[model samples]
Target: MAAYVIAYDVGTTGIKTCLIEVSGTIKLIASATEHYELHVLENGGVEQDPEDWWHAMSVTTKRVLERSGLPASSIQGISFCAQMQGLVLVDRHGVPVRRAMSYMDHRARLELKEGIANGIQIAGANVFKLLKSLAITGAVASSVKDPVWKYKWVERNEPAIFSKVYKWLDVKEYLICQCTGEFVMTQDSAFAALLYDTRKGKECFSESVCTMYGVDMTHLPRIVRSTDMVGRLTANAAAYLHLQEGTPVFGGGGDVSLIGVGAGAVEPGSTHIYSGTSGWVSTVVSRQLVDASAMIAAIVGANAGTYNYFAELETAGKCLEWVKDHLALDEINIYLEKKHVSEAYESPYESLYDYMMDAIKNVPAGSNGVIFTPWLHGNRSPFEDANARGMFFNIGLDTGKTEMIHAVLEGICYHLRWHLEAQEKKVNTSRVIRFVGGGALAPLTCQILSDILGREVETVENPHNVGAVGAAIVAAVGLGWLGKVDDAKQLIQASARYMPNMANKAVHDRNFKVFKALYKNNKKDFLLLNAGR
Candidate 1:
């Protein structure tokens, strides 16, 4: 028997609601998306209203259910795949005390310096504090964007909001509370706070870490497994979503953990790369590991007794978005002028990228000696520098916009290669990588990524919705429709495979060396120009 379920992929900028039918295989029935505001504060803070998340969820859920013609009673379960490391402090009634802080928020620089950057240091973090954090949590709050620093920032600056804080939650946890009225955090979410002890058989909040960071332990919520039935939908939430009141809600996980399941990278040593607004390279492992020097660690996995050696790039596809807005503004205007109004059914934002790809595909492998860094919002893995900014280097007088755009894509792949190499140094990464997220929609990107890494890259059907698919898999496993999360490998199949073009290896290698050196050569300048920016 097939079971119906809904998975809400709540991302940084929008919500994608997917309706799926689960049995021997997962079938996506229908889906819808709704965008929301991401308020970028002048103080380097990024936030979004919790009400916007709830509104987008309600709107997209109704749209998907309507498109599928499935009654509310037919849906068996609901779950979420959301952005991680966000801070959503809510009151006793589950209402947010202020706008939810995004994972991109880095306004806690002073707090981070005071809390972790002070005293004797290693890799720009206090040696004693780093050792204690790694011994307990297998991770450290070394970045200014880390959630603990944001928590401390609120406590110091917004004393009134902090006073009413009942429990701290991430983006999906807040939505879970909205749906079920339960104050809970999934295991991955808890570990992301860097205050959770990930030691085997002792996965919970660490009192010593909390005290060391001056974080109030009471602000943490009850931690739950990703597949556990957290609660049932409340009447108000059900009415708002046009669903049944008692629909079971499972504890879904952060995108970093669940997207790999959707990509069928479930076994230990399996690896996947996700490129969306943000990007990461994740490899499944049996035990926790940390490479403090590289700023990479094995984060708690969605499944028990599993961990993911995760390396991240804070902004990947975002660099492409920057090009679309700034470099290709004229192309967009021309594209809009040439298209008929009826053809507007297709999104101009997407079609414009397709048009840009048509232009970039002809621009040779090395972008004509140009190299761009995909650090528009700074970098995380392999280096932790909030002051780092994106730049186009080695652009000769003959270079054109097409070559620069091609370099942006190559730059993203180059950074992924950096992360892949870092992960390989510590543990064995997959020879062939599963690539997911919106970036995989482009065959050119797939081919370029394959060429840059000198490995095969595979993408599954509806690659953009892998996060939602992973959430649906979690729901299926929870409903007994699937044996376990790893069983997802039997259901999802790769739609396309991109093989590396060894012919272009030399050019890419030359560019890659320059790409890596750009940061090191300009680190001092980046600090001087972007400090406090």
Candidate 2:
């Protein structure tokens, strides 16, 4: 009876599918989520099986469609937004070569260091190479997470696997190829390669830049705009998704840009903070920018002729998950004892956050002088360092478990403030920021971020689904359901705002000073400090 679009978001931890109806007012009909595993190696290698992502997409789509009770033909289009910077290599037959290298993977740090050692030209490239790259792409990351670096790593480390590669693709491109048999990537996804000619204001893979990254240009996929029709649904994919054959599919982009739109950050300089498995502070802008010193960059946005300035802190909501997995289990027994339920066997994993929050909610803002550093796998934003380790500093005899847990929460906000400092230089992020992500669901986190930023942090009714909503909005615009790029912002209504609590300002101010000093003072030869590091 009404028109609908299926928006699927493939995030670091999971795949979330949303069936959204656009009949005068945009409304979510049904939603489903499926999580996969991240294979973390001791040597800083991080990967995920592509097949697992496909399987999750298959199941989640079918389930969401079933719950919506809409006919397959009624769904007008399907679009996607996926985690950025991941490498998903496929062969001539479109089969994944091996486990995909996640954005979190830093196995190519050796390559990054070698490039930096060459000179101050590009910091990671020679003067000529740096000028050419900056002229075209605006930003270039020589880190292991760059798709180009992943290719170089494969060529050097796994020659056999590298030889079979037919194309170098990121998560969004791989998923698009999987759906329609179209070996193409959107400009937003192509931005991840740091090999695109962005200065042209036209989307195309740059051969010269690819050569600079030591990657073969022939292995790259074709580029398209985010709103362009990649292709119709293939019969097999449609069947698996329980949707009509030949359903329109738009060329969706990376999560960073899509989330900016979904969070109503379509206006230039409209800022938002995202926290899922990985996190960042981003703002939509009309102009191109690059700051090599601070490691922040502005690439093309999900919408045409716009850009998004993204500064990542690497970890946000992930810190919460880490605490849950490692520390919350012990709190379960404490909860049992406090409640006098005699359920000693109770697993803390089952309400991990609630238990931790119960303790954290009661603790003071300063965590009673306890401090936690969130560099659990190192940091990538405001600065780049791979040898840094997560630390628990300022712990004293009086510090309790609750104080330690509260410090972890505070520690995440502290890093976010540091990220904001860099973002403010390029964009005015001093105003209210839209906080959208899985992390925004936690009231404590919202309040902490607001207090730390000294501004308003707002969340919508469906904070976690904003990425999927943004993808759907892209399709909706292409389908003529929406008039302009900014019109889609109305779909998400901000229902709550967390204002700064001045009561904790003085304490946080003192702690923020120490937070910066902790990183500065602990600067050491990490290789020598921990040989296994």
Candidate 3:
């Protein structure tokens, strides 16, 4: 018999809870997820109600516990890995002050530019400040999506909320506080705070940086290690989840860090690719690195004294949703749903995914020469450009919906390959990379990605559940169930492996050339066009 750890993967759109065995080889006993709303404004605003996240966490926690049929006391620890770069301002009593400003929010674009570099300086940071930030934090971003600018946006636009906020917390920190009744942050979350003096032996709020930036360091939470047992579960949290009053609540790293663990990328030189709503390529490195131009950073990993080279694009699986919504696949959808009606679930997204995958199964590569730019929300890695837009270049009179769909899929992989190539500059990117995320369930997508990157892409069972697995493993380590984080690799078992189809190599190679040239040719036009809006 094996004991377990309960963990949560609080993501951008929802919360996932898992009851996982904490023995030598970690394994998921049961898992559940609850989704919430993503409110997007036409003016580039994206927000989510904080209460929804708490509700999801509570609901899923109970569901997972019930489904696992394991006594709550058997669960030795609890932890979380959640979305980063989002602000969740809370009052002294752990209540949210306002809707969280998501990483996709662009309402602070002007504020970020004005405060940082107005896009004229290196990587959008003021030239002098850039050097200092790079030296201290090893990272800097002038994007509106950055939490620093989001904080300034609130202070400038919503002064009342700022006045009442007791502390600014990330999603995981807020979740932990809600469960443990202790307001604290993990080291990985603190590093995301641009004001932190990360280069120091003790990572803390930098007084000099705060003074220069006019940020109140008092608003930041105290930092704690991921393996630290912050506090026992509070009575309120315990009652809501039907768990014991004194369940150990441990601190775990953020979602990406935990995902690295879930993907078995804990060792330095291991690379992993993740593609969900957003896509990123991360490689664990021995030291800190910064490529301001590419918006790449070697930030803290899940463990102490380790770093991960990270870069990402704004869109990946999102493009599929865009296609599903915009295309008139009525005939195909009806046919596929009828074909697989017995296999269909209540989730419309799942049904639609099946329809789209079945419809595009035979579509040849290169999308029949239609190249799509998956910069629907702008580019983030390999280059930073808000003005960038998605396009289906080389569309011909014969272009059909299926070819266009394939192009969209191919486009996302191409952009990821671009990010991967850029990441290769700083890290020894492995020829075989571990791929994990919700999108990994799609064999076609994985095959396309492998073909594009010329790398063997492998996915473990329940790719989307990897984040929860990572969180649970972190908790297990904190509980003495595991000796070290890397040892948790015993939990991982590869479900699928994708290899490049050499016969279509020429087609992808030619299209890749066109893909690289598309952005450069439209860079000026992208800015000029976006400026008007």
**Which candidate should be chosen as best, given TM-score against the real structure?**
1
Q: Once model 1 is optimally superposed onto the true structure by TM-score, how far is the C-alpha of residue 395 displaced, in angstroms?
A: 1.8
Q: What is the C-alpha local distance difference test score of each model?
A: 0.91, 0.81, 0.82
**On residues 1-533, what C-alpha lDDT tens digit does candidate 1 reach at each position?**
88999999999889999999887788899999999998987788999999999999999999998999989999999999999999999999999999999999999999999999989999889999999999999999999999999999999999998999999999999999999999999999999999999887888999999999998888899999999999999999999999999999999999998999889889899999999999999999998889989999998887667898999999988888889878864653534443343345334536767867876788899988999999988788899998899999987889888889999999999999999999999999999899999899999999999999999999999999999999999888888888788898889888999999997867899889999999999999999988887
Report each candidate's C-alpha RMSD, comma-separated, in the order given: 1.9, 2.9, 2.7
CA error at residue 238 for candidate 3, angstroms? 1.1
Clashes of 3: 0
> Native-vs-model 1 lDDT?
0.91
Candidate 3 per-residue C-alpha lDDT over 55-166 given as tens digits, one digit per residue, 9 for 90 to 100: 8977998898889888777777888888888888999998988888887877777777677874447766888777777776777655667888888888999999889999
Compared to the true structure, candidate 2 yields what TM-score? Answer: 0.94
Per-prediction count of colliding residue pairs? 0, 0, 0
TM-score per model over all chains: 0.97, 0.94, 0.94
**lDDT by residue for model 2 (1-533), tens:** 45799998998889999999876766789999999999998877889999888889889988987898877888899999999889888997779998999988888766665543266655445666667778888877655566667667778899999899999888878878878998998888888778888865456878777766677888888888888888998998888777888999998778998988888888887888988877888888888887766778897898777788888877778887888667765664544333454344435523546556765787888888888988887777776777777888877888777778789889988888888888878777638889989878788889988888788988887888888888988898888878766876666678899889887867888899899888778767554564344
Error of 2 at 437 (Å): 0.6
